[model samples]
Target: MGFVCNGRYVLEPAAADEAEKYVNLLHDCMEETYSAIADPGFMVRRRAARDESIEEFMEEVNGPGVRCFLAYEVPRWTSQGGLSCAVGADIEWDAPVGLALSSLGPHEWESEMPVVPVVAGTRDLSQLYTRATTHGTGLGEALLRAVLADDEPAYLWYIGGNERAKRFYEKFGFQDEGIFGECGGIWGVPHGEPGQPLQTARMFRGGVVLQ
Candidate 1:
């Protein structure tokens, strides 16, 4: 499935060959996100992990039961000499801007999740991210909608300090379960600062019947 959003981006199933582009986008987005809450040196420490994400990304993209979607920027056209240009005609996709990865099942980190009553048959939203430059252009929302079905029971984890992400999920009817857990390493960066373990909370939404 493919769709355009806000005349600025297009969403489509990610190609297996685009692992490098996907890793780069994820690195930039995560840096922008964690820089606000993490120590200044955190990104420096995360460099090796960021560089190594290509392998993991490739594995996941080609892994079983995983659906990965990518968003590409749309080319902008302008009229010449004050004439109207056929803006939407012959639209060309520019560059990759965002990505979302979802999976059914027992994810790699499921065992690490805080012990709680787990929801049965829930889809795991493993990742949803967009370049910081594309924020507010509805790129993130479009990518999210493309990955998960409406009224499908699903869950995702958010970093503790990322209020923006928490609020975004809330808009889609996901609620925080109040189960907090600490991750020593996230995306290959260790939360080594004393008393500052990487904080996380799970957010869930019920399917149609439960809703």
Candidate 2:
């Protein structure tokens, strides 16, 4: 079951109808985080590309072994007709404020760095984003915990120069393994200026054993 965090946000698995909304929320968060680093025109093109690939994205997220979680801000309670309304009665959830997406699969790096044998069981965190306004409300951690609550062998990548993201993952004991490359080379999309490419670095946490 999904849970509430900070008494103001509810975290739960994304529903089937949320695919498009998830994409919109994802880009909103990306714009907030990477607008300074990404070329303005590139961002526009990427948005178009994402729109065209919505179906693909949905398929991947809903694919077997994948887990996607969404977090919504809790609305305030109201009284009606001199009666307090039930918390879950007709409550409308605004667009999601946060998302965490992960999948269990063989470890694979999308860069030219020599490929390594795939681990039998690896949970790769594909995406995580929270609107800037939701920062510090405990929404991000709640989303993260939904996907990865243990110190398992897992991996993820973060855009270069995102110190806030770096610190957050570090708090979870994920270490940078010195792997670095252009974002486009790894993701097959021009997420930054060709003149000054957006770089990404991988972080990994390897501990604890699967039962």
Candidate 3:
């Protein structure tokens, strides 16, 4: 069972049929959040590519290893309605979002050290973007906290140059692991001008272990 946040939304695990819908909403979050750093052409191309890859996206969300958590705006009286956001992850295999998705297994570093399962699509699931918004309501943090409210070690890929993301992850004790990657470059699809690559990095910390 889960509790209400923001006086209306319920945070809980997503249903089977709902996985695809969540992935679709991922586009909105990515576009809105990364819009400042990306050009219009890139956004358009990305959206189109995502739409065409719905099957692949759905497979990612519904993969056996993946578990999805979602936020929805249910009537405070009854529990049913608009799907607000979602976050999903797989701790077993390679995830469609470019994560190796494993814990206690081989890391990309060519070593056998155990790694933490990656939290997938959390940034998208933690954000609420309605047309009637005037400013951030801090509700995203609530959604994010719902999925990550744990002591077990988990990791995520934080994009470079995002101070807000850096600060948030820091609050959870996720520190830079000194591992760096490119936006699409990790998958060999580098964006930006030849010399200007979009870089991201790894951050790890023992679970926040909130008292």
- Estimate the TM-score of every prediction: 0.81, 0.82, 0.60
Against the unseen true structure, what C-alpha lDDT does each candidate score? 0.71, 0.70, 0.45
The Cα error of candidate 3 at residue 1, in Å, is 6.3
| Residue pairs clashing, model 2 | none
TM-score of 3: 0.60
lDDT of 3 at 83: 31
Model 1 has an lDDT value of 0.71
Off by over 4 Å in 1: 77-94, 117-121, 186-195, 208-211
Best by lDDT: 1
Q: Residue-pair clashes per candidate, as listed?
A: 0, 0, 0
Candidate 2 weakest lDDT stretch, 10 residues = 77-86
Q: Tens digit of lDDT per residue, candidate 1, span 39-121?
A: 56666666656656777777778877787898876555222311123334344433577889987655557567765535444
Alpha-carbon RMSD, candidate 1: 4.2
> What would the per-residue lDDT of candidate 3 be over residues 75-114, giving only the tens digit for each residue?
3222232233211221221111111112221123422222
lDDT of 3 at 38: 56
